[model samples]
Target chain A: GAGVSQTPSNKVTEKGKYVELRCDPISGHTALYWYRQSLGQGPEFLIYFQGTGAADDSGLPNDRFFAVRPEGSVSTLKIQRTERGDSAVYLCASSLGGGRRPYEQYFGPGTRLTVT
Target chain B: GQQVMQIPQYQHVQEGEDFTTYCNSSTTLSNIQWYKQRPGGHPVFLIQLVKSGEVKKQKRLTFQFGEAKKNSSLHITATQTTDVGTYFCAGEGGGTSYGKLTFGQGTILTVHP
Candidate 1:
């Protein structure tokens, strides 16, 4: 089975420009999550989706960061007015269940976003 | 807000030596998961622990969840070059917050032959 995957392995954009990153979760996975990883740091949670609705989004840094999982299988993280601080590896993951406790998550290769 | 902290941000060991990383949470966690990420790669799930004072092993790797549910540890016996990577511990807060995971800083392990 194909694992989770993201598009645009690398993206370089000018600061203040808008950008969108896509994620394709594994088949039959109902729980999808987005995280950001900075250099020399662990992944920071960004948002989570259960089905077509966002189950948790407290991790989103600000209103400039938004994500949507319209079909419950694929998701997109959108950034408005990107900043240099937003430059990092954007990771996407999915689990078999709807984020039940102790469920293992499969991760995607990630999209490295560089705001120049 | 919950925070997960990991100690010994980096570890260097020779082959056949042992390596360990510790994770602590300010709040009690409903479950904890461990992940490994090789350089220039995405994170891969290794294991998850939900029970208090639980211990699980995968060949040379050992994982332990504290009785308090606020701490965890990963220990590797007889380290191999293949084990060189970053180990991260992520915890899910108790209650209805099932999808959000608070990740620790992570520990980078380097094994020399």
Candidate 2:
């Protein structure tokens, strides 16, 4: 669409439940990123995508967290066996693919996930 | 592990007062970008500094990149109630891995009316 968009705005799930958060990036943006923000902290990088491929997933905290952008436009972040520690805001951003200027990142209204 | 640290975690300023925040990187940065996130809102991009000792301004907001490329600052000349938000400085380390930014702990600014 016009800007990065995320779905469900908020999600509250119980421990051991699986949850999914979705993000739809700006049209024609080939670079996408996901981040997590805990209380009183800045967003932390979780993964980055170049097209449909994850160029970097080093920031994923554990195997329980995973994300995919199969079509390079819409992406999903999945959490398995959600824990209270996983409660945070999930953010999505997009930018024009690799070039001399990787300066700006358009972000979405993040999804607040609360694991009880 | 290449982190960014910000000082003065919280600041309260009266409307029309000036506010400033500092960011320091564990390593030299290839570039620095600033963003603002209002309470309960997502972050919005502000500006980026690429050249050493570079300074830029947007209205009352001034941004500076240090000559060492290891630190940066954001100064709001005349803060307004609308300027109340958390300001963050993200650093891109010098290398191919520099494309992805590592953000500093943000400074939450509260502007009193």
Candidate 3:
């Protein structure tokens, strides 16, 4: 089966420009998550979605970051007025949700966003 | 806010040497998952520890969950060059926010063959 997939393996954009990154979760995976990994650092949680609604968005850094998972499958992370600090590898993961035990996450190749 | 801290930001080991990385969480975790990411690659899940004081092994890798469920460790015996990568420990709060994972800083392991 195909694992999670993300679009635009690399994206370079000017600062202050808006950018959107897309993710396609594994088939039948109800839980999807977004994370940002800067060089030499761990992945920072951005948002999580269960079904079509965001289950957790507290990890989002600020109002400039927003994500949507319409139809409970594909998700898009939108960054408005991107800053140099926003440059990082955007990772998307998915797992089988709705169980007492947490399921392991399958990650995508990630989209590296560079704000120039 | 929950945070997962990993120790020894970086480590270097000989091909036949042993390597280990430790992880600690500010809050109690319901489960901890380990992931390995090769250079220039995405993270791949390794294993998950759920029970307190539980230990799981996969070939040369050994994973241990602390009795307090706030810490964990991953050990690799007789390391090989294939072990060169970053290891991450992700903790799940296990409440209403069970799906959201708090990841550790990650430990970069380099193996000299």
Q: Candidate 3, residues A1-116: lDDT per residue as tens digits?
A: 89999998999999999999999999999999999999988888899898999988989999999999889999999999999999999999999884466888999999999999
Compute the lDDT of residue B89 as modeled in candidate 2.
95
What would the per-residue lDDT of candidate 1 be over residues A18-108, giving only the tens digit for each residue?
9999999999999999999999999999998989999889989999999999888999999999999999999999998755655788999
Better of 1 and 3 by DockQ: 1
A1-116: candidate 2 lDDT, tens digit per residue: 37899998999999999999999999999999999999899889888888999877878999999999998899999999999999999999998874346658889999999999
Q: Fill in the DockQ of model 1.
A: 0.80
The TM-score ranking, best first, is 1, 3, 2
Task: For model 1 chain B, give the 10-residue run with minimal summed lDDT.
Answer: B93-102
Candidate numbers, best lDDT first, in rank order: 1, 3, 2
Model 3 misses residue A30 by how many Å?
Answer: 0.7
- Compute the interface RMSD for each candidate structure: 1.3, 1.6, 1.4
RMSD of candidates 1 onward, in order: 0.8, 1.3, 1.0
Residue B76 lDDT in candidate 1 = 100
Single-chain TM-score of chain A, each candidate: 0.97, 0.95, 0.97
Candidate 3 local lDDT, B73-101, one digit each (tens): 99999999999999999999887667888
**Quick one: best TM-score, which candidate?**
1
Cα error, residue B48 of model 1, in Å, equals 0.5
Q: Write the per-residue lDDT of candidate 1 for residues B1-113, one digit (tens) a residue.
A: 89999989999999999999999999999999999999999999999999999999999999999999999999999999999999999999867778788899999999999
lDDT of 2 at B72: 98
lDDT, candidate 3, at B21: 100
